[model samples]
Target chain A: MGRIPWRLMFAHFRRNKLRAALTVGSVFMAVLIFGFLRTFIVGMETSLAECSANRIISASRLSLFAHMPKSLEPEITELAEGKAEITAFTWYGGIYIDSDPKHYWGRFGTHPESFKKVYGPDLILEEDAWQKWTDLRQGCIIGSDLANDENLKLGDRVHLTGNIFSGEVDLEVVGIYRSKVRSFDQKTLFFNWDYLNETSKAAGGRKDCVSTYCMLLKNAADSGPLSAKIDAAFENSPHRTMTQTERAFQAQFNSMWGNLPLFFGILGGVVLLACLMVTTNTMMLNARERIQETGVLKTLGFTKGTLLVLTLTESLLLCMFGGLLAMFIVQSVDGEILMFVIASVPPSTIWLGLGIATALGLVSGFFPARLVSRLEIVEALRRRA
Target chain B: MSDNALLRFQGVDKIYKRGDEELHVLAGLDMAVNAGEFLALMGPSGCGKSTILNLAGGLDTPDAGTVTFGGEDIGALSDAGRAGWRSRNVGFIFQAYNLIPVLTARQNVALPLLLTPLGSKARKEQAERALRIVGLGDRMEHYPNQLSGGQEQRVASARALATDPRLLLADEPTGDLDATSAKDILDLLQRLNRENGKTIVMVTHDPAAAERAHRTLKLDKGRLVHSTGAAH
Candidate 1:
């Protein structure tokens, strides 16, 4: 036929309503999940890409879990020779009333003044919030997302029971910070490192120790020499330190989740393949039902190519419609849905998901279209009759 | 025969295999259908009445010899080429009506016209004309399920006539219809032949339906065993 009648292709759906809906619904869920999971990997990648090159994080040489003595900061400061400003980070992994990951946020204890100065650009705060936290003994600044999730107002008390530092700690909220640079997470609560040491000393636990020392260099080029000097200074000490650029440091944290891009790629690929198989099965069922109709079309002078096009178009339409809907749904989704997993699905990921869906449609549609093309007209007509 | 024949089969053999055994559906069949003729093929079940129809329409190829239309060997054409040829020259009406349930009578009638160069408006107009010819003008907008058995068959007839094909093949067109509906279909077929000058080859076991044709041929085990002069 010159232009194959689209209605004929659409008729398969009209005749068997349930099968068509199910096929489209499967495609929708596949695209949605793929896009949703892809957001996490994309977010991690974005954060790693945005890390400041000028900063170096000094951590325990043994592992992320091992802590280095805070006294080592002065040795690193001397090695930098006034070329860098230093602050320390103590990861206070804590749980709010419940232990669910959704209710969790990064709790870091760092020198309030030095942390504020080092991360000046990343942390957006009110001018008075810093002065208030500076004056208050037990004050903390929380991320914008954490403030919103916990609905904590300024001067409101926030309590946490820590795993690393032990016992319970209560603090007043002094500020809420927002960050465009993702490495400085928006879901963290930064408190005075002295407060953590004091509490630990009071509880008879080890004090004046930190997870990482963050050194902000005056020149980004000095990162290499400064990092090497800092490592060598603590190499033989009981509290040995490993030092790297902030970018590499953030990358190491991301590596904790394995090869992120490959992990999500494989996860999404598996979902799409599973979707293709399901669509192929659905298409096969449709072809079986339309065997007689296709034979009649053949008898009416429809070529094998025309029949194949018809079948493929049906499959493509289902996937395209579902994928387009899923893409939009991912774009407009509320941040709370993936609160702990991902901040939001980026535009690039949405387009990528749609592309994957379209390819799945074309490849999946081919199997059944090939079957339709090879059907013997007489055999089909006879078989159906 | 060469001057007048629209379709010709010479020494044709068709065999179908069932696992290990071969069924010879047609054996050295020889026949010709002249232009402007109404020919009926009658036979018992499994007697190859429909096989000849299938061969005539280029739906299947013969194992030996040739089936030609207007002196062109259909078996020689590629599958796609034959489909084009069928679109241009052949129209078929089936016993079960075989109408796509979703399409209206006019749309079903316009199916073959999609292969032509006609614009959508022209195809629609031609489909309406065909429906009116089969006395179903009022039912043109109705779908197959919405119409009665006879009306559905009339829509099928309209479909067969829509392309203005040189040959029309009906495979027991009234097999599923009541006697009244069957007679109505036979009357419509007869009118198409005697008035419109369409060349039709209809397959049927109904002697009553066969009597409306200009001539009747009977097949037994794929061979022409009996023949009757023009019934009209």
Candidate 2:
């Protein structure tokens, strides 16, 4: 068997610059959309995956909208039976120190000791920042993005207006933390729960109330048994409790995107189908133009198999070039948009784009390659057009 | 046309069918060429002259009868087998100089030899030798687009001679050339036949071109009707 003439095949692409550009552009767009859709899906899922695995969330039996009594914290913690651990936090729903209505960051109030125990080690901090965070009474920990966005750093005093608490609270910025996990660390601001509770009591609001408790199973494998025990302990309480894995808790937030994945899947399929059509059209035109060349090859001792492989190789080369271009663009731009859109994009999304481009090349090249292989050499040679 | 016959076509017929119409292109044609003879197939357009050359070159199969090259029945062989046979025993020159546009003249000439077991270095040497034979040794590095029409056809001739095939099939080798280039190509074909003992079968509409062959056979209505030559 003769060696494949790869240079000859590439020369065909080089000779027809406009046609090659159009075909490659179609492939680039296809891969770009594929990468975009894949990144969104992976981003949403990563948000759930990045949730603290050691943290278990306890909410109301009915829904997250229902609140639990602060009095139940001790009862829930006692049910641990040395095989579980616990911490508690409340959603603060606070606006930024800046007056802009659109300036929102994740704000939560938690017991300082338990919050530090569960998350302190993972929150890679600047030197002395962790000590300052633990020592100061009015200090709040903010994400690096939040600090950068508001120009707030260590020892900067800032006032946050709580939407749910109905008052402005003065807090000193003690530390800035970046996410070890992609999702949680990027958007949160943490303050002492006692401050909010004390303020609510002074304002004659509900005193013995908190939103959620986070538990840690002693053995990761004991999550199921520990969850069942926690739920059983609070079964008949005035405010009933629901215990679930951290993943399920985060997934509740994802449910808000309802039917989005399905919509994106359908949209992605349409884009890929359009890409296939464009690729097929381009390949068909290519095959028609090279009929005489193929005939020449056939007469020069190239078998149908060789012809098929060559044509398909040419198509795959075209698509792979576009795939690389798309990959470059996505790698360059996806990080910034994703940080704003959904916080972070996963590496798997890039891999998925590459896989999709490969599959697209094969599927799209099939018909045209087959047509070239099955062509009669005499007829093809005779077909001047 | 017995044991020494290099090619034999016996009662060969090719009929092309389009929708409800039948076009009998080669109707029960029988012909034979000796080992070192140069035969010209001459006729007007649509007279199946090219078709005969195509059959003789093993580029197409006869529908009804046997077309044999070197004792092997070409019609009975598979497509790959026919291709292998053509690569080993036949070389073709087209009027338009069907050289791969990107390849240099030497690379184009080396194409048919790629089927041989020769290494790349050896293939290059043989290709250079064939180019030298066609008086294009210095022009071997030039691409088809870079060379003149006559130079391109000479490169095509060099390519045809590269495989050391016994038979050379030229389909109007000078059909796309000027008078000078056409004469150059015909003179090369005559030298290849007389000196190298290659069996040459060419299809041409030009009488001047046909006059250079060892024998000229005219086809009319899918059958060889007239022959003027020493019957060998």
Candidate 3:
């Protein structure tokens, strides 16, 4: 046994800078893409895990896009039988600023008082702002992320043009609420349902409708039974209801993308395979170029195992460097945009990236190291090219 | 030859096969070199000059008979045992000045000492001393490609002598050098053999190179055909 030739192993990289750079760059790109794909999968899991255990979401049997009569909330509450608190809201789908036609975001119409009561501390709204919002008919609350991004403050007037309704509605930004959950913060803009109804009726449009209802149970364990009861009560109605826990509701919304996460997962795996092949080829080329040197080292009394370790260390160093670079780049990029896309790259993702890179290094370098170690000294010396 | 020679080849045989043809490189060869001897083996092409060096250095084993060094039969040792023996007892010099291109002269000279338990600082100091002995102390930081043919051979010589081994095996040590460089390398080998009391077995085809050794043995086909007077 001998000390590892650390300087010699790294000196090979200096001799073949272009090849080393290409190998490292390929690993960097592959692992970064893998990290993003994994982030999306983890982000969905985090969203579901953060859902309130005591809350149940009730939607139309057709889809969340399908509307139900606002009058049905009382019937659903009766089914709860004094055991739950309920609230309802519909998707507004508003476009911000006429000049920036692509600058669109979520705008939801809700019963503000019930929405606050149901959400409780999860939605942090100041008392003064809450009082202001309740006093005005056209007042709305925006998420802190949206408020900071759009430079909107309290007392600022906002005129949103609805995508589904025929006319524009004027509203006042009375409060900014910060969500405990990051995914919720990036997408929230809540306006009064009564204001929406009045505006639509004044413009001769349809009114008094909501797309979904949410119920908060007295005991979290009763969600399953209460959800079944609520659905059974509305089972024979014209608009049949489908009720489930909030976690399950989020999962359904996630499934609407239809195998996209799975597709990205497969794509990430393919990228990893490509990286392994490329890295293997790079190491093979490196070993071939150093055949004579390997023979010389053997004659200098280096054991076959020492040669194998040296070669493997070279590949591992390259991959580790690439993994760190990719993680830094991913983390240093815009966080708000990443959160908006529902892809949250956590600190643990960096560790995962490094672990995968190390595995890649080991697999890619195995054959090349074996080939180098098994080289016959006479044949290696005789090889000219 | 004396009974207590430092290296002994007894009825040694070596053969190589190329598809269907069997080439008998060395057949029943017998030779001996006493302690502190400078022996030069010379002959025409394909005379098994390098094969003898390989067998003596434990790089290759004979098909039959035994090659003995320091009273032990090297052919009887296991692969790992033979490798350990070579590291502790033998130093080799090749014609191509086979330095690892990526390493500096100091690093190349220090390579053999890596197998020993010497720390990095001690190894570096010993390598520097070896380089200075070969008159290349200032060139220790230069790479093989950065040195001349003569300087590169000096570095190779430094690397070979760095381990202070019991026997030095050289195969065409000056084959790739110019006349001036060849003379310098031959002079350095002769000094190492005579002044340092190191037993050396060099294989070369050059008559002028053979003249520098204390004894010269000529080989044809596989057996020794002629011998010069010896000082051993």
What proportion of the real contacts between chains A and B does each prediction keep?
Answer: 0.86, 0.56, 0.52
Q: Write the per-residue lDDT of candidate 3 for residues B1-232, one digit (tens) a residue.
A: 6775999999999998899999999999999987899999999889888889888988888998899998899999876677778888888889898888989999989988887788889999999999999999899999999999889989988898888988998889999999999999999999999899889999998989988888899999988999996648
Q: Model 1, which residues run further than 4 Å from truth?
A: A28-39, A61-63, A66-80, A94-100, A123-140, A144-176, A193-209, A220-238, A259-269, A329-352, B2-4, B15-24, B63-73, B102-106, B125-151
What is the Cα-based TM-score of model 3?
0.88
The deviation in Å at residue A269 for candidate 1 is 4.4
- Candidate 2 ranges beyond 4 A from true positions: A17-25, A46-114, A121-128, A136-183, A186-248, A320-354
C-alpha DockQ for predicted model 2: 0.47
lDDT of 3 at B95: 89
**Ordering by lDDT:** 1, 3, 2
The regions of model 3 sitting more than 4 angstroms off are: A67-83, A95-105, A136-187, A193-209, A219-240, A260-265, A324-353
Please give, for residues A1-385, the per-residue lDDT of candidate 1 as tens digits.
Answer: 4568787877667877888888888999999988777777666666667789888988998998898888887887788899988998998887787998777788888877888778976778987998888878789999887888788889899888777786667899999888766666677788888887888778877688899989889999999988888888888888788899988987787687778678777887888889989988888877787788888889888899988888888889988888988888887752433533334577777788788778778887888899889999888876662
Tens digits of per-residue lDDT for model 2 on A137-228? 67788888777867888888877776677556688988888867665645567887888777766766545567888876657777777788
Docking quality band of candidate 1, CAPRI definitions:
medium
Chain B superposition TM-score per model = 0.97, 0.97, 0.98
Per-residue lDDT of model 2, residues B152-195, tens digit only: 99998999899899999999999999999999999999999999
Chain A TM-score relative to the true structure, per candidate: 0.88, 0.72, 0.87
Candidate that beats the other on lDDT, 1 or 2, i.e. the better one = 1
Question: Each model's C-alpha lDDT?
Answer: 0.85, 0.81, 0.85
